[model samples]
Target chain A: MYQALFFLFAASAVGFAINLLIQRHPIHSALSLIGVMGSLASLYLMLGAEFLAVVQVIVYAGAVMVLFVFVIMLLNADKEEPSDRSKMAKYLGLPLLFLLLAMITVVIYRQFPEDAMVQFGDFPGQTAAIGRLLFRDFLLPFEVISILILIAIIGAIVLAKKEP
Target chain B: MPPAVILFTLVKILLLLVVLLTAVAYAVLFERKVVARMQSRWGPTRVGPHGLLQPLADAVKLLTKEDITPSSAFRFIYTMAPLLSLVFALLAFAVIPFGPPLTLGGVDAFQVADPDIGLLFLFAVSSMGVYGITLAGWSSNSKYSLLGSLRSTAQMISYELAVGLSVIGVLLMTGSLSLRTIVDAQAGTYWGFLPRWHVFPQIVGFFCFYVGAIAETNRLPFDMPEAETELVAGYHTEYSSMKFAMFFMAEYANMVAVSCVATVLFFGGWHGPLFGPPSLQVVLPLFWFALKVFCFLFVYVWLRGTLPRFRYDQLMAFGWKFLMPVALGNVILTSFVIVAWPALSRFWS
Candidate 1:
């Protein structure tokens, strides 16, 4: 069941992304982007990252998407004419996408050992275990990442706001 | 390898999925009713016995409604966005420990999948929900939708830090990442009366989490994404019918997810007073869990009534400057206290 779900998610992600690239309208492309995020979140679940999955949906789908929609409306990007994909660009892009997909498939097929299937077990205290790891072992890096995020927040504000 | 075990687990998964989907349906009704009361009117009374059947009606309406795809829009992406949102929302509930594992027909039954990295899985899936809104807004090719998506993204990213940090205190006290273990760790009491709920030791963490959760859900005060006066329905402006309903469903599901996490971390999930009876031990824990979750849900509703919408800048500033720093400081203080007092660690153990 898990394996089937994983493959379904990956296939949906790749298919929707390809569709997104081929779509003429920006709106359609944006919607396809959502499909990509969803598939990724599902993949995370298959990898045993429950908290990451929730965070992915809440932060990425719920909040970030809202912002994307806001910007789409603010810019009135929907009314703009859909630009046709140039033949030259398509020639260059198609191979790149195929190469990326092939690489991903190879990596998955190679890295994941068949015998490495995760067995369900006692999961009590998993959050606490993560907490200990984050605070004790990964404390310095975690703090640094947070600071970097803070900087990003500031940068976003500066970029979004109108200059005085 | 037992056939019975496999059958039982499959049944359990199906059952839980039904319950969760049902809960998602009712949560929407609950929100509408509560919001109506706040606005000085009875909500959904005409549906079924004070609108009890309103969700079913709404679902039918949505399913039957016209599903329009914009001519210029990205058809594949636009269709996929809502499905992605709904899928991730459903996924987050898989690891949530609804009640203690119960024995059914000689088999031990628990919630859905219980992966070792359950909490992280929830976080990752929840974060992925952003893509749905972003895609919806962008694919709609509408300015209003884009602006809404942008606000939602910024808000979620900013508050997620505080939300993650707030749970550190509970993690420190419990020393387990598993939802079941966290509840088990808090099963008893300290000083005979004070239950070992993390809320006492991690009050600051709780406050930060509470605020961040509200932002994460795009509830009042942090609902810049759907600021009707300004953004005009935000990211889902261009979405109609079932596609729009999917986003609605995701919001309520996310709310429940956060509430469950808060219950486990700070409210001593499924842990209540033991009356020294064996039967009570089995039933009371589930009751406690339900009570805690209900209280959090009530608080969610209450906040909607009590607080006004926050200015976008103020919301961003508060999340980054106030909540983040406080959460960080609390973590430091907790670590210091744990290290300084060996007795405290011993007491928890």
Candidate 2:
């Protein structure tokens, strides 16, 4: 049952992505993008990462996608005609995409091992493990990342705010 | 035997589903009544004795209403958005432990689908609900809807950081991410009569989590997405009848989901006054759990009544500046306390 749900979610994700690519209207594309996010969240749940799954839905699918659609709507870009790309650019892009896809497939097939199965285990406790690593072992990096986020936030305020 | 167990599980799930749907229905009525009372009105006093059947009436009204699709909208997406919203909303409750495990037919069964990483699962699915709103707004080709979707997206993303960070403190003290384990860890008392609630030790974290949850749910004061005067019903402006009703259902469902998380994390979920027959232990904990959840839900309605809607910029600033920093500081302070004072840390254990 779980495996089937996983496959269904994955298939829908791919289907949504294709729909996103093929859709003429930007709004339609944005809507399809949401389907992709939803499927990804489902896949996360199936993988036993419930916290991650909910966060994916709340943060990425719920919040981020809303922003994307909101911006698309704000710009009123849906009525705009699809960009007419040069025939040469389309031809070149198709092969590059195909090559990337083929390379990914080859890498997966070649490096595939018998130990691909994911096993869930209790590693003491999640909170304890994260706390121990975050503070004791990875303290400096964690603090540094937070500082980086602080900087980014300050930068965003400065960039977005109008001059008095 | 396997098939029997599966069938039993299905039966339990169906029962829970019925309860949840019923709860969701009444939750709407409750909100209406409370909000009305707050506004100095009689509230829902019709339908079935003091508007008891208001939700059913509303449901009937919604179902019979015309479900219209915009001519220019994406056909598949337009149809799927509400369904996606409702599904994700319902799924988040899967791992929520309504009460302790009950033994029936000599087999112990708890709530449905308690994956090892249950906490993460709730977050993942709950977050996915935004798609439905955004898609509905964008696909409808309405500017107001688009704006509402945008506000919702930004608000959710911004508050999510605070929400995630705030929970880290509880997770730290409890030392577990599983909801069941977290609640069980808090069963005993700390320093006599002061219950082992994380709320006491992690007060700042609790506060941040509470505020962030309200924002995350798009409730009052933080409900910029659906500011009627500003956005004209926000993301679902173009939705009619049942489609619109799905959005409404998702909102309440999200509220319940977050409330459940809060109950488990901050308030000792399924842990309450314990003075009964030893056999009644199982049932009492669940009662306490429901009581705590009801209190949180009441707070949701209360805030909606009392608080004024926040300006968009002010809401963003409050989340990013005030809430996020405090949450981050609490985490750091918690880490410091745990590291610097071994004597103090022993009390937490």
Candidate 3:
């Protein structure tokens, strides 16, 4: 059952990612990206990281993708016609993308062996455990990241403040 | 995984769907009746006794109406949007605990599914629920649709933060995100007098949560997206017939979902007085839950009739500046109280 669910979501994730690239309308692409995020969230659930799965959907698919779709809608963006400026991305970017994918696959394979299986409820990366980890084990990194987010918020406020 | 578990889940899902659809239908009737009374007029008295059969009539009318597609509209997304909205709206209920856990033939059978992150799952689904309105507007290829969607996207995004943050106070007190655990935590009474509901201690959080929920659901005082005078029915301006009915149902369903969440989070969910035989005890929780939910639906309609629509700027300012800060402060206060709780008790003793 686990493997079946894993294969289903993983295939959908890849399919949606490809569709995101191929779709002409920006809104279609944005929706495809959301699809990818949702499928990836399911894969995260299969990994026993329930907290991560919900956060992935809530933060990325729910909030960020809404903004993406919102922008596409607000601008009334039309289908993309490739401009002369995108030559490098169309052809040259393929090899780089493949290399990145390969690198990630290699890292994952090395980290997880066949015996390192994903039995759904075996590992507990639940909210409380994750909380303890962030507040106790990785407190400095967490605080630093929060401070960075605070700085970003301040910067955004400054940028949004209209100049007289 | 097992066949029994799967069967029970399927049964639960079917039952919840029926209950949810019925709730949505009656909520509409309830709103119309109450709003009419507030305006010193009769509402839907012609259909059945006290408008009991009104929802049935509405369903028949909507289902039989012509589903017109605008000439220039984006057909696929336009058609898909309302279903998306409705599916996500109903999906949130799968995780919500309707009553205490009940087992039938050795299978846990009350909730559809109880993941460790059930509460967060609700948030995730609701956040995604914005897409229905957004896409419907964008796909309609109409200016009104675009404009209405623009407001909804902005409003939902802005209020989503406040809503999520407000609930953190409840999470802190309960120390868990599962709706079942949250309900369990609120069971019994404080000092044998006051109900041990989060509402008593986290009143500020409840305030922010309820207000944000109203905004998120686009109810009165925050329903800028659908202001008839300005936007001409907002995102659903181009929708007609069953398509329009879907959006309408989605709106009422979303309202029910939020109200259920409010009841579970703040009020003691199904924690009222219990008595009588075992069978009655089993069902009284459901009764209390339905009663509380009815009260919430009444309040929602009451506000709709009583309060005027907010100016768009006022809505944004209220959500971002006032509600967000207050919710953040409530979270801080809750965490502080929880952390210093032991010391405070020691001091008292």
**Candidate 1: stretches off by over 4 Å:** A1-164, B38-40, B105-108, B274-281, B343-349
DockQ scores of all models, one per candidate: 0.33, 0.49, 0.87
The worst-scoring run of ten residues by lDDT in candidate 1 chain A lies at A119-128
Candidate 2, residues A33-93, lDDT tens digits: the string is 8779778867765665555555566667666766776677667774557679899888899
Query: Candidate 3: lDDT of B131?
Result: 92
Per-residue lDDT tens digits for candidate 2, residues B1-349, read 5777778878877887888889999999989888998889999888999989889888999999888887877677777788888988998888888777776653345578666567766766656666777677767767788788778878887888898889888877766668788888888899788999889899999999999989988899899889999888998888888888888888898888888889988888888887879888767877888889899999999998988899999999999999999999999999888777887777678
Error of 1 at A144 (Å): 10
- Which of the two, 1 or 2, has more TM-score? 2
Residue A63 local lDDT, model 2: 64
User: lDDT of each structure?
Assistant: 0.79, 0.81, 0.91
Give me the runs in candidate 3 sitting further than 4 Å from their true place. A84-124
Q: What DockQ class does candidate 3 belong to?
A: high
Per-residue accuracy of model 3 over B81-111 as CA lDDT, tens digit each: 9999999999999888888888886656667
True C-alpha contacts between chains kept, each model in order? 0.59, 0.81, 0.94
- Model 3 reaches what TM-score against the true structure? 0.96
Docking class of 1: acceptable
lDDT winner between 1 and 2, please give it.
2
TM-score of chain B of each: 0.93, 0.95, 0.98
